[model samples]
Target: MEPTGKTVVVVGATGPQGRAVTRHLLGSGWEVRALTRDPEGAPAKELASAGARMEDVASLLAAANGAYGMFSVQPTVGSPGTAPDFSAEDEVRWGINVAEAARAAGVEHFVFTSVAGVERHGSEVLPRNLVSKWA
Candidate 1:
C-alpha cells in the first residue's frame, strides 16, 4: 500500500480493533488522530490521542477537522472495559454521531466496522448486542 501521508481520524482509538487500525495506519505512513473520551486515561495516554466524546458531534467534528478520512468503530454491548450502562441503542447513537461529525467535517473517506448478525434487511434472529445496529 502506498503511503499517502494523509490524516485519518480514528474514533475509539483505545479499543481492540481501533488499536490495530491505528498501528497499521501509522505503519503505512498515514497520520492518525486518535479520538477517545478520556484523553487523560491510561489507554489514551498509551495511544497519544485527543479527547472526543461520541455523544458530542461538535467535539468529534473539531477533532476530525482537516482530516482526509475517518474510521468509526463503536464499542459492543457488555464489552470488556466498557461501561456497564452502555447499551445497543447507545452504540447506534454513537456511530450515528460519529458519522454526522465526519460528514460535517468534510471527511472524504469513511470506514465503519460492524459486528456479525447486523443485517440492514430484516432478520428474525439478530444478535443481542447488534439488535439496534440496523435499526
Candidate 2:
C-alpha cells in the first residue's frame, strides 16, 4: 500500500494483538507510535526495532497529539505474566483513560480491542476480565 503519511498511536503495543496491529500498520506505511508501561522491555524494544516510536502510558495523550488514529488494547485480569492482583476495575479504568486521552488528543479514529464472548455471555456470567470489557 502507498504511504498514507498518517500516524497512529497504539496503546499496549507490546502485547500480542497490539504488536500485530503495530507491525501491520507499519507495513502498510502508516507511522506507528507505541505506548507501553515498560518502554525498555523486550517486546517494546522489538517494536521499536521494527520502526514504532515508543512512549510511556503517562504520556499517551501527548504522544497521540496530532495523530490520525489510535489503536487501544488493555490487559485482562489473570493474564499470564501480568500482575497477580490485577482487578477488573483497574482494567476498566485504564480503558477509560486511554479513550479519554484519545478524545482529548482529537484522534480521528479510535480502535478499541476488547475481549470476545461478552455478547454471548452476559456480564454477570462472564469472568472479570471479560466483564471488564463490557464495562
Best by lDDT: 2
Per-residue C-alpha lDDT of model 2 across residues 1-135, encoded as one tens digit per residue: 788999999998988899999999999999999998789999999999989999988897899899999999888897754688888888888888999998998999999988766788777888766767666
The whole-model lDDT of each prediction reads 0.76, 0.88
Candidate with best TM-score = 2
Residue-by-residue lDDT tens digits, candidate 1, 9-41 = 888887888878887887787878887666666
What is residue 30's positional error in candidate 1, in angstroms? 1.1
Q: After superposition, how far is residue 131 of candidate 1 from its true place, in Å?
A: 2.1
RMSD of each candidate? 4.2, 1.6
